[model samples]
Target: MAEGFLRHLAGDRFDVASAGTDPVGLNPGAVEAMKEVGVDIARQESKKVDRFLGQRFDYVITVCDRAKEACPTFPWAQSLLHWSFDDPAAAEGRAEERRAVFRRVRDEIAQRIRRFMARERKANKDPAQ
Candidate 1:
């Protein structure tokens, strides 16, 4: 999800990267959902947050509440934001039901990213206006 969003903003002034504590690899359901919206994530590999520890980030965002709770403090991070979303991979029931969950999660993440991009653009344009 984060990868798709970041790809949308790639080559811009902001630097974006995503990693998970467990790093269980990209969910197939997530890959399909993003593909529905024209974003391909099949090549992306899940990485451990530790891989980014020494780097600097203007904002470190956690897309899951549990991750936010479990993540250790990063002294170099200028800010941390928690944008919790339901874990679509955890969805159960029929196959169709599971796909629905993934679709909903994908849409939610896309909406949040769009809003964030809009605000970022506005902030860049106005600065203090």
Candidate 2:
């Protein structure tokens, strides 16, 4: 969801990618939640963190606590950021209940992405930042 929002909101400003320590494919609830906001993440694949090992990036961000702990060091990355969010995939209950969890997390992720984009824009405008 973060990737989708960043791509939609940031446009060509940032090259965004997301992976997890333990991927369990894309969640249907997540896809539905993104679709609700017109952000189609249906084609986004869940991938293992190993796929991006050794790659250099301006920022490497982890969106969950487990990921923050399990993520390997990306010394090549200029910055490492951790935004702890609940693992909505782990949400348990009936279909609508699970969808609700996805929606909540999706909204949270969108809000965080907006803040991140704003910070980046501000930093770009200020030389001393």
Give the top-scoring candidate (TM-score): 2
**Per-prediction TM-score, please?**
0.91, 0.93
Poorest stretch of ten by lDDT in candidate 2: 120-129
Query: Model 1, which residues run further than 4 Å from truth?
Result: 9-11, 126-129
Candidate 1 has its poorest 10 consecutive residues by lDDT at 5-14
| Per-residue alpha-carbon lDDT of candidate 1 for residues 24-100, written as tens digits (9 for 90 to 100) | 98999999888888889898889899888978888888999889887877889987878989999999999899999
> Relative to the true structure, how large is the alpha-carbon lDDT of every model?
0.83, 0.89
The per-residue C-alpha lDDT of model 2 at residue 112 equals 94
How much is the lDDT of residue 37 in candidate 2?
Answer: 94
Off by over 4 Å in 2: 126-129
lDDT of 2 by residue, 1-129 (tens): 888888888888888888989988888888899999999999988999999999999999999999999999999999999998898888999989998999999999999988887789798894542
